[model samples]
Target chain A: MTTDLTDSILYLDAVSVSFDGFKALNDLSFVVGRGELRAIIGPNGAGKTTMMDVVTGKTRPDKGAVVFDGSVDLTTQDESAIASLGIGRKFQKPTVFDYQTVEDNLLLAVEGPRTAFSSLFGWRSKVTAYQIYEALSIIRLGDLKYRLAGSLSHGQKQWLEIGMLLAQNPKLLLVDEPVAGMTDAETEETARLLTSIAGEHAVVVVEHDMSFVRALDCKVTCLHEGTVLAEGTIDSVSANDRVIDVYLGR
Target chain B: MIKFLFHRFDKTAAYFIAALAVLGVLIPILNLALPEASTFHIPTYLVSLWGKYLAYALLALALDLVWGYCGILSLGHGAFFALGGYAMGMYLMRQIGSRGVYADPILPDFMVFLNWKELPITWYFFDHFVYAIAMVILVPSLLALIFGWFAFRSRVTGVYLSIITQSLTYALLLAFFRNDMGFGGNNGLTDFKDILGFSIQAPTTRAILFSITALMLALGFIVARAMVASRFGQVLASIRDAESRTRFLGYRVENYKLMVFVVSAAMAGIAGALYVPQVGIINPSEFAPANSIEAVIWVAVGGRGTLIGAAIGAVLVNFAKTWLTGTFPDFWLYGLGALFIGVTLFLPKGIIGTLTARFNSGGKGDTA
Candidate 1:
């Protein structure tokens, strides 16, 4: 099969995954273009999270190829290898190391020698420090850098996880439900942050809040039953009869 | 390692090193310089016992490196300790030369008793102290590397990993008890004459061994402290707190586990090598799963993540064990059981953790 290599950073061709004979992903073909920000909106069981799992190499598709950066096959790599290949995923639930300080959380996520030997003896350079500082300012957790991540509020924890994702400096970022538990103000801030991040790196955000999606103001893809139901601007997609029926009909 | 120690010397770590240094100096003086009749003088037997305790502390420190830091709870650590002990025991056995009961130049007495024709090929290079020392570190590390590679790569963790580790030590126990294993079977290795040409029973040698044990404990603490303070240590702690998160952050979690597991095993092996010389014997009992469990309890009681706490837990619990087993005899195990239960329910953070929380929070407890 001849695949278009230059247009997209990630392409999933008819990807299908089943768990114990139950289809979680059903022949879902999708693509995310380079340096593009895409918002995925869907109902509870529309397979949004499963689609993310497939991209992050957390789950394998029984059929179809997940091509990354045009030529790299994501299906052939494990989670760590996929992560190291410049793809970072933020989970739906915030999962920061609660016991460590916020600064340390960022440090652990920093791109450098990740091996045991290097960490034991590796020198932290000026560039690494500057990157951590930049991340801290981006996440707005500079004042609480020394505080344990466990002590942070839920919204703050979500931001910290996002900040950690930023620290990885990946070419692609898969953020799942970033504003799920966030307040209105925090959600708006996240919208701005992710929007600003999109131009420098390709970002795929799976979110539910329509206002937040409107705030994103990017190309929106509405999913239903593990396939793309609608793809357009926020207003256009929301105005689609099919998209409206899929959200309200079920 | 020294750089980290000097740069990151905190109160807890500093106290640990100071205590070791003090003990190292005072014990040698009390046993050698001070008159035996003086109340301040330490008896020779007591010195050896304390030396054994220090070695146990080192073992506990090693356990804390993996368990407390990286969250790999290995209950088969005693097997590594015993393997290192056996390596040292082999060298000592060779030192016995013609002094053994059978007086065989090459074969140890137990091998002669078992009617073996010659020294087993596995025991060949152990006659050399350097080779024995190398084996003392290498054998346990190699075993840990292989075991951790399989276990971590398969994503076996928590209680399942603990169970497999326990099974490993139990397996070693059974094998070492077998006559055909060529490790002296049920009797194991004992009746040592010398180590590196120094008389094993000499007071000066015992004092030297005690000093060496203390030095080793200090160095182990420094190395472990430096490790946990490093950036690598940060990732390890993250893994302990959230394994999948660390994995998705681009860390090869299994490789990290294997590395720490092998390092901890090597440290445990060194502790065992020091232990055999001070205790003058190496037996299959050292490989008992219960011994490993007791070591875990020591870490729990002292506080798991605190390196100094583990060392303190080992020395204090073992000191109490020596005292209680003498006075109350059968009550010792019950006391230990109660302590474990009490620590779990009331002091989940253990002694050091609780104390630190109090100190840090000014007794508020919430900050902890």
Candidate 2:
């Protein structure tokens, strides 16, 4: 029961969501601290993505409320406004602007605070484009900056999307399946990317790749039937009976 | 950087294309000075007729703003256009005043002919062109806001959204056709004596109208360009590419879509208002779904996602249609349909798109 008072960045009360007589998220509650890496793993239909959706304003919860930065009520705000409050999301499929170059994709993602409009008149300003370049370099995408996003390989696209998220400079990042279909090396690299960014920003990555999750060695949250089934280190969660049943097909 | 904008246009045969557009605008003006029956004599009717096509080009640009960049295919845009036209038409009808044949001064001649006792209360203040201009832009904007609010917030999309939009215009077509609707019914509000005291039939007036059309087209381009370069356009692009994903990315997807949708409708409205004055007609035919579909074809033929391409497509297709129908009246639809099919299959990006692609490839992007 050691709740870190100084670091909590997000607080989700007993939140729930129902769609057409089915419960997608059932009374889930959790807290994420500032600059922490949280990975959510679960069986299919475990509502992991739905939880992310709720946090990011894609899905509205039927009950309960969310607080961000310890004060901002996130329940009523629109996605853009919520995003303005410093939340960024990367989809499972890595939705970058396909027709745009990697550089353009990052340029388009400069959102929330000093987003697309402010940058135009100030694009050549030394600090801003430099920041974009730095984000690209952080994702190791600086070499392929001129390539169209659609031309990127799967792992690269994932990294590009992560770079886009990084370009947004959100305080909390909700990344879904960051390495869903990557090679072993790509998966390892992605884990490293998350780890590198974790100390400066809180990251919530939803993935099924155990090795990737193990590699990051972050807090593990196992979800089942839309609620937390277990929460601990990867080793302890894997040994839990309920988590084993859900992950190993009972 | 405008790097995208410059690259997009520079490689798209912009020089030749621009020359043709300038020709399209000037021909109607140049034909005005020709003698009535001389070899160079061009009919005034033809000039106005071509002007109508330019108005349609404006509509295509408006539609492209939403449909091309935002992925919102509004089948009901015709309704908004007609609404603006009707607003202006109301002002025009009021301007007829005591000068009308019936001389009731209060009611338009059609209202008096239909045995209406007095002017419809809503018909007040429309006698002024200033009011007409305001209404032309305002009416479409209001209608778009209300309709878009309901349609988008409710999460209506794809074919369902299309059907609703279709029904909206169809409903307007029905409402405006009534003799008691105060819009002159099927005959519509025509026989315009003046637009702010200028004889609309005069060649000078014609030239002014033509130039205004060109100016409006240019302004429309600039405004659309500015918007697309803004954060507004990025949201629209995201909506086009991955709407659901955008929603999760913290965009109020519906608000962005709705705002652009309303703005697009207002642009269409302005186009329609300008159209009525030049063409000397405002009728329910403007509400026809086929007309809207033709507008879509104009955008599609030019390029679905390209803003200026839509305007170019509108002028070129209508110009071609005029030429084709005049020569081969029997097979115009076949030619038009074939043109659409050919563009779709062979050049899915439209003429500007295909040309730009080649241009970019020529520049050597060096695909990995």
Best by TM-score: 1
Chain A only: TM-score per candidate: 0.95, 0.92
Task: Report lDDT (CA) for all predictions.
Answer: 0.90, 0.80
Error of 1 at B25 (Å): 1.9
The per-model DockQ list reads: 0.67, 0.38
Task: Please write out the lDDT profile of model 1 over residues A124-182, one tens digit for every residue.
Answer: 53346789999999999999998899999989999999999999998899999999888
lDDT of 2 by residue, B193-260 (tens): 77777777877676667667766776677667667765567667877887775665555778777778
Cα lDDT of model 1 by residue, B1-368, tens digit: 45666776787788878889999988989899989899998888999999999999999999999999999998999999999999889899998998989889888888888898877789887779899999999999999999999999999999999999999999999999998999888888888889889999888899999999999999998888877887778888989999999989988989888988999999999999999999998989999999999999999999999998899999999999999999999999999999999999999998998888778898554561
- How well does candidate 2 score on lDDT at residue A67? 77
Using lDDT as the measure, the top candidate is: 1
Q: What's the CA error at residue B200 for candidate 2, in Å?
A: 2.8
**Count of clashing residue pairs in every prediction:** 0, 2
